[model samples]
Each structure stands twice: as structure tokens, then as C-alpha cells.
Target: MNARTADAPAANPTSAPAGTLLHELSSSPIAESLRRELLKRWPSTPDRVREISRYALLAPGKTLRPLLLVASADAVGGSYDGVLPAAMAVEYLHVATLIHDDVIDDDELRRGQRSVHAHYGMADAIVTGDFLILTMFTSLAECVERGVPAAAVLEAVRVLAEAGADVCRGQTKEAELTSDPSSPIADYETVISLKTGALFRGVCRAGAILGGAGPDHTEAVTRFAEHLGLAFQMYDDLLPYLWEPGTTGKPNTSDAGNLRPTFPVLLGYESAGRGDRERFTEALSGRIPAAEAYERLRELLESTGALHRARARAETEAALAREQLAGLPSSEGVGLLAAVAELSINRDR
Candidate 1:
């Protein structure tokens, strides 16, 4: 669906549209409760760290990771309540990474506002990120205390740790390529997959595992999230070139000005624009079950056409992900899960 539609309640606010997945899933009671729990977990000791962390973590976001957890639980016939702690853990970890990412990138803004480092200074921001990471571990410990098996908690932590490493590697790779105009598309994909896809995969897999889904189902969910996350990063990269600062509610063109090898830069402006259109077309080609929603999504992405080829690759990956879920049991949550994949492919911000 279009970004606005995706963000808004369906045509009927009282009842969700048929196949209008993620609308309520993201706003589910379990997800909301988990968000509250996470907010409580932020370090409250020193006023400075607490303030910086709160500002950074409380920014407006879709809270997609927790939604994935709750949705996966429902898909497996499990109670979303059972996985609330784990879901919060995932979100805490994500915020931790974002905090560190801002510091590393020297980003001046986030979510249309000054970044923590910019507003609070780099030292405080770095400590804030560290506190969040530690809090994530504590949250995971709470999950275990709540009767989730030690194995499940451990596995989730492993995945999160690996994802963190992948993010670091991706950042390093991106740094290396920033000044090099001839970077290969494959390299860019690798970076995006490692940096962005890794955490998305971890979130889905952790959700499935906590939901008690079998290994195969967890893998399927992970694959779906991975592809969707890559598409998210690609689309995010394109935003800098296509949107004005206030229009996107965030600063634009940092990548372009920094000489980063974004899709538009790599493919050349015209080719990249066309590629985005083609990808949007492919995403809406009815090759997947969520094609109708994908059409709405296509309309959103086609406005930019700045990362079409990367988007096309994401479409292929998303199609494969849908195929992977064919063998899983059907549930209302599955539709929401699929919708999340579609949304990721076409999200505007």
C-alpha cells in the first residue's frame, strides 16, 4: 500500500481491510504492551544517559520487530503474551544499534530530529548505546525468567550478537566504498544484507523460535524478513536522492554528498530511476499472493525510481519468501506476516 495508507488505518478504521495485514498487527495489544515494557527498561540511573537514551528510543517508529514477534507467535498458535519479553528485547537491541550507528556515521539527525550525538554529545550517545545493549541482555534474561527455555533465549542472543557483528562489517564495507564510485551492486547487496537484513532475520527467527514453531517454519520466516529488510535498506538509500528534507521528515542526500555508492550513484540517475520503476512493476506483477497490496506499494516507490534494480532484486527475494511459507499452516497471523514483507518492500520512510 502507499506509505500513507500503510501508516494509516484502512479505509474503515473500525475494522481492518481484508488482507490488510500489519495495520493492526503493528498496533496489537501485545506489541503495545511490549513497547511499554521496553520503555521501562531504558537506563534510568544517571539523568543524562537516561535522557539521551529516552529521546533516541522514543522516536516515532513502526516498531516492526515487535510486530514480527507477535505475528509469528500467532502464526504458530502461540500466545503473543508469551513472547512479549523477547519482543521487547529485540526492539531494545535495535535501538542500541541505531544509537551506535548514528555515532559511527556522524549522523546529525534521525527521525527528522537531531541525533543523540548531535544533541547530547558523542560520549553520552555512545554510553547510551552501551546501556541499551546491556538492557537488551537484561530483557532477555527476563524472558528466561518468565519460563522461556534457556535454549531459546540463548539462541536469540546468539542471533542478535551475530547480527551486531554483521552490522559492524557492513558499516566497515560501506565506509570503504564511500569514496569509490565503481563499487559493484553485489557488494552493495552484501552490505545491505549484512547490515540491515541480519537484524530483520534475527527478529523473525527469534519470534518463531519463541513461538515454538518448528525449525523449518522459523527458517521460512527468517528468509521472509531478510528479503524484506534488504528491500527496506535499498529504498532507504534511494530516499536521499528523491525526497526533500521536510517532505521525508528527515535530512536527505547525506549519502550523495558523502560520495556513498547508493543505487542512484551506481546505476546512474536515469538508469536507477528506471530500475526502481521496473522493480515496482515486478513487485506488483501478481507473482506473489500479496500482489494487490504490492500494487499500492508500487505506486509509492514508483514516485522515486531511484533504486529500482535493487528493489527488483528484493521483489525476487520476496517472491521466494512467499513460496517458502506455502508449506506452513495457515493462520490470520500468516497474512499479517506476508503483509509485513510487502510493506517492507514498499515502505517510504
Candidate 2:
């Protein structure tokens, strides 16, 4: 990670002369709206918790999960306004998990800045995370008030709760695995899928439900979200090794101290390198055939073939997601969904 200016904006694909998957999905209005909403619900009970919550929630991030919710809603031709609460809820839930995750990982930094625990102390960070988790439920209650249908709200809550549990499980597994140096790649991936993919799946499911899709559509969206989430995490796995200063918003060698089960470390330098290439090739080779943007995504992954295998797995999942959406009505939101799938796998930061 490179030292970036404190107020520097997250890397944008075009402005930075780097290609990231999120470029096509960027929506300032949507992101701003989400921030405002999250701020409105910042912990108000305890002043200390409020401050801690603000620091964590207001941190710089791409807001990918919310974007996914909004895009998924759009894919079904639903109004963004209608889905805003759910989107916010998903983001809040995600932030809550991050707060807890930082504590568990004992990570000192996040998004190139001190993590909540580092800035506010561990006890306060835990309280802050708990507050955020409860606030997410409150947000969900508000969704019910907004006429999103009780069932839909409940479904989202259920997915979120299950995901939360899965994340905890993943964390436990990781803790055990990391203690021993012999953790297998498959084991690492399993933890990632549960820890990371679960929330992503929830994001998609919430969107599909809010969009008023049928059972089949919901199932398909779930599949798409699961694969997309896996891809997203796979990309994240690569970041710890490949991150650059000013580009990744953190120290280039930040993960070196952690000694976690990252792709490069697990596969070793040579085999990991070859795996990335082969995975990307398989990902785009009709294994999970997608539509128009698939080729563009494939090209992007291939170009960055240094991490091709991880990228390819992500692409394959995105491809599967695209296929899941095929039967749904075509709309601009759908296009956004497709773009988001590409973005999740191809982002540089």
C-alpha cells in the first residue's frame, strides 16, 4: 500500500488510467444517498458508540454491496427509491461485519486508514459493531414501513442473519487454519465463500425480492449473487499480494505481517502464477457463458493474467450469474447488474 492523501478519492478506473471492474457501476448519486442514509441512523444511544459508528461507516469504500442491491432492483425494472432502504440495510450489515472482522483479524488499518479498533480502542469498536448490527435491523424495520412487504423484509433479514452466522463460522475456521501453516487452498476458499459470499448472496436476494421477482427469479438471482460474491472475494484474495501504494489505498506489503492464507502464499509463487492464468481462461471459456460484456471482462482478466486463475474463477461465477438473469425482463438495471458482475471481478482496487 502506498501513502495516499487523506482525502483522495478511491481509485476510479478511467481517471487513474487503470481498469477496474467497478467503473461501469459507479453512481455518485446512489452512493451519496447511501452515505446520507447511513449517517441518519448512526448510533445515537451512546455518544461514544455514535462517534465510533460514524468513524467506521464514514470510511472510504466503494459501497459495492449497496450498488449490487440497487442494480439488482434495476435489473427487474424496479425503482431505485423503492430499494434504497434495503440497499442501505445491506451496506450497514456489511459495515458491521467489517468492524467485527477488523477486531478478529487484529487488523490495524482499513481503506488506508486506522481501523475502528485502532482508532477507538477494541471495546469501543465491539460496541460500535454491535450498535451497527442492531441499527441494520432497525433499517430493515423501516423497510417494512416503506411498504416493501413484510415477507420480503423478513426474507432479507433471514439471509442477513444466516450470512452473519456463516461469517462467524468462516472466521473460526480461518483462525484454526491460520494457526497451522498447512491449510489447503480449498479450505481457504470454503471459508471465503461462507464468510464473504454469504453476504453477497444476501445482497442479490434482497434486490430480487424487493424487485418483486418470482420464486424462480429469486433463486436465479441468489445463484448469481453467490458466484459474484465468490469472484469478488477471490479478487480480494489477490489484493493482499498485488496491492500497490496510492493505487490500492494501503501499504503494498500490508499483508506480509499477517501471513494469512492468501492465494499467492497458498499456491506458492510459480504454481499460483500459472493457476491464475488457467482459471481466467476457464472462467471466460463458456464455462458460465454470459452475454455481451463477458468478452470484455474476459479480456480484462486475461490482461491481468498474473492473477488469472483467481480472476477466472470470479468470471466463471459472474458468467453463471449472467445466465441466471437471462430469463428476467431486460432493463437498464439489468445492464447495471451485468456491469456490476464484470466490475466485481475486474476491479484494480
Candidate 3:
């Protein structure tokens, strides 16, 4: 599925294409309600923080995290009426990360537009990110007002708060690994798990808790989310090699420019001969221009079969994600979750 903002309804979900399925899921009444609540909770204001936040929150992209939260709740027989605030909370947390991440990575674009830092200056972006971080907790707290147990809301807060900390540690670890080009595949796995998988697992587990699911089902969904997140990050690393910025919605050279040791680059380097290794190291160190590094890495990744290997790993993770679904009862939400697993590896943007 592509990361298009506009949501469309599906006439026949069973027979619809993957993109349509995504649009259908995103346009569901519950999802619409979440959108309304988001707009209502954070209405237009003259304050710069509020203005920037409104832009960031309503940006053109797939609302995947919140959708996952709500869908997980539905899968376990929970109604949206009780889970909307929590869903909003996850999305706020996600956008906050994106804002801070753009600044840290020096990325100029996000969701097909100028990144928060690039468009709004670094100081404002940082402050806006902090505001959103605090806002996420308050949003989660509103779950109790919607009839969710205070205990469940508190637990969800703990889960997401830890997940946020994990993201920071992962970012730190990634920065450290950049100096060691030969960091093992296991290290890459660990980084992505903490950076990407942690929040995914948090949202799914929190959703299960809000839905009143038993421990077994909650564990299963958490595992599913973790594996899916890993696959998502793997595929995300491949997009620059497979498509242009116009298609991917972000600059294709951001990873190379930032000297990120993405999975594809690492795999290609590991399988490469001495000559290829030197070239890759030079490209990684920004000795070459970003566009050149991007092209060179793509060629090397293709030649060394690293691209194929990375894809295979993503497929394996997607399969693992699907396997966890068996623990949950059959429902529309479960089916949507399975489709999301499929989307992780197959998405173009």
C-alpha cells in the first residue's frame, strides 16, 4: 500500500486491492471518529506550537500507528468509543518522534513535504516535539473519561513511555554503530527492535489491554507488532534503492547523506569483496556525494544479492507476524491486522 493521506471507502473489502483495503481501514467510522476527536482536542490556535502541531499531526501520510491501536482493540472485541483517546495518544507520540528524528537526521523532507525542523526552524521544532510528548500522556489519560479503567490507562502510559525511552536508546546505538561499519546483522536487528518494534509492540499491547484481552492474546499481538515493525523498517531501508523521491515521498539520499548503516548497506558490505568494501566505506563516510553513494550502494546491494537477502528477511518477519495472529479470534480487525502485515513488506511508500 502507498502512504497516501486521503482515505477511500471500499465497496467490497474482501475483493479489494491492498491499497483499497488500507484506505477502507483508514476511512472506517471509528477511524473517522478518531480524526474528529484529534481535531477537536487540538483545534486551531494562534500559538506557534499549536500551529506547527496541527500541520504535523494532519500531514499527508498513513495514520498507521493509531489505526493499529484501534484495530487491535476491535480485534479483541473492544469498541472504539473507549479507545479513541488512546489511539490519538499513539499518533501524537509518533509525530513527536518524527519531528525530533528529522532534526537529528538533518532530514529536509517528511510525508512529501518539508520536515518540521526544515520548515519551522530547529528550536521551534524541538519545542513542538516536547509539547507533543507531554500531550500524548494527557491524551492517554482521557481514556478513563471514555470509561476505560484507570489501571488500564496507567499501564498503557507506562508501556508507551518505556517505548519512547527505547527509541532514544536505539537512536544512540545506531549512531555508535555508524563508526563500526561491520556491525553484525544481529546488531541491526537489535537497533530496529528498540527503535521501531518497541512502539509497535507498545501500541498493540496497550490496545489489547484496553480491549480487556487476556494476557495470552495481548502477548501474541505484541509479538506480532514487533515482527511487523522489523519488516517495516527493513523495507523502508530499501525504498531509496527501489524508487525515486517522487514515489517514496522523502528524499532518496537522506539515509546516505546521514551516513546511516541501513540493513541493505550492511548486508551488501558483509557479502562484498575487498574492493567493494572499500568503495562502500568511502560512500558511507560521505567521501562521495549523496546521490553517488545512493547509486553505488544500490548497485552493490543488487550485485551482492543483499537486496534479495534483505527482502527475504522482511518476508520471514512478515510471516512471523502473521503466525501470531492465530492466537487471536477470527474477526474483521484480525483480518485487517493480517493485511497490515502483508503491507509491511509490499508497501511502496
- Tell me, by TM-score, which candidate is best: 3
Strongest candidate by lDDT: 3
- Give the worst 10-residue stretch by lDDT in candidate 2: 1-10
Best-to-worst lDDT order: 3, 2, 1
* Residue-level lDDT tens digits of model 2 in 34-135: 666667866555577877777777787777888778767666656666677777778778888988877876777777688899888999888888888888
Tens digits of per-residue lDDT for model 1 on 272-328? 355654453433334444434333343543554535665576666655555555555
Model 3 accuracy (lDDT, Cα): 0.83
Off by over 4 Å in 1: 1-31, 39-46, 269-307
The better-scoring model by lDDT among 1 and 3 is 3
Superposition error at 313 for model 1 (Å) = 3.3
lDDT of 3 by residue, 215-304 (tens): 888888898899999999999898888878977878999888888889988998898999999888888887888899888878889999
TM-score of 1: 0.78
